[model samples]
Target: MALAHRILTIRRDPHSGEVLARGGDPEAHSLLERSGFVPVVRRHETYHRLPTGLDQDEEIRLATRAVARLQTVGYDLDTDPVFATERREPHYLSLGDQVRHLAVRIREAESTEEVADALTELTATHDGILAALTKVLHTAADFLQDLGHPADPHTAARLRHLADERLHVLASDLRHVRNDLADRQAVHPHRAPCPQEVAGDEREKSASCPCPAPARIPTTPSAPAAAPPAPAGRRR
Candidate 1:
């Protein structure tokens, strides 16, 4: 998990850097910070080692869906002679490919453990895609800024809007993956009852009861009250 956390951190920082470069919302910094954390290394490693097959059909289906969505959002860089000349479409396609690969992995997974592993991979891949998108948008912003004119407000707005929208979607996907994993584990036959459940009331009684009288906190003796001041102008 720690390794997974590190991977996520590495992926998100670059995205945050891109967001900063374009003068986009600074709030993304907080969001990025919240998203990255040290994952449990043992658990993460276990998940990664789980065997799973790639579902090519599902991968293709997801890719097609993503492409359709991108199309709806006017993502036709190749058709735009100027954009095609600039050649940024390749970068976006690369990101799309990474996402597709992860999607395929997820679809192919057989067990809950394998699914969890795939989800982790998907999270990392999505982070990379977001980072790449951020870089491209920042590049576009920079190019416009270098044109001896103020950056095109419309373009900046659009790029920022897209970044924000994608971030939301990614967060939602992450949550869904986590919930699915939890649900799977709940139904896993091998799962042992919690220790607390086995111990029952005896364990609870052994542990200090929260409702018991509170222990007094020790404190240093208070300083003696200050002596009253001498009467003004009177002998001490």
Candidate 2:
């Protein structure tokens, strides 16, 4: 039910005069973030706002682009006049979506070796995703450490700590697990790779060839309604 009804409102706050966008699905939120809006994640709901200190024209451009992109993906937007646009900008896949395919591969794999191969793509030392993420964190930390803001130094330190400690441990553990899986050459008992071809003795061509359906639990059938009672006056 989570992204069932995608709707949003883009307008300047009545009191603060800051451009704000609220009430959207995750896809709409991602579009706003790509369009240069900052997300304000609250306990119950999340919303986006134009980052502070932008010129009015720049703010309008970002807001209008967000509206266009969200609308292009079929979101219903209630927008202010300045933020409304007739444009329906073409959408592109985000980098995060591309990276998520690794998880899909692992899920669909029928053997430990296949899973290990997918994990190698993530834990590979040279250009793996974790390596790239470590670089991004360090790059951000270096930029923020000397920004002259009082809180920025601590924020940068937190990022450095995460990259140096938590992420390193995770990558190391995953590397170990991947190596172990790579050594195992057995297929999963509950899963097998389908050949995607019909066997010579197959009876029904339209039915599943070699793949078997997942086992299902038996459900109790409801009792049939009792037959209507015979008319007592006529029969008895």
Residue pairs in collision within model 1 = 1-39, 1-40, 1-41, 2-39
List residue ranges in candidate 1 displaced over 4 A: 1-95, 125-127, 146-151, 179-183, 186-236
Model 1, range 80-167, lDDT digits (tens) per residue? Answer: 1111222121213434466668767656555567667656654445454445566677677656654654547667666666666875
Candidate 1 Cα deviation (angstroms), residue 211:
53
**What lDDT score is found at residue 167 in candidate 2?**
95
Off by over 4 Å in 2: 2-4, 193-236
Alpha-carbon RMSD of each model: 22.7, 9.4
lDDT of 2: 0.88
Clashing pairs in 2: none
Task: Name the TM-score of candidate 2.
Answer: 0.78
Best by lDDT: 2
TM-score of 1: 0.31
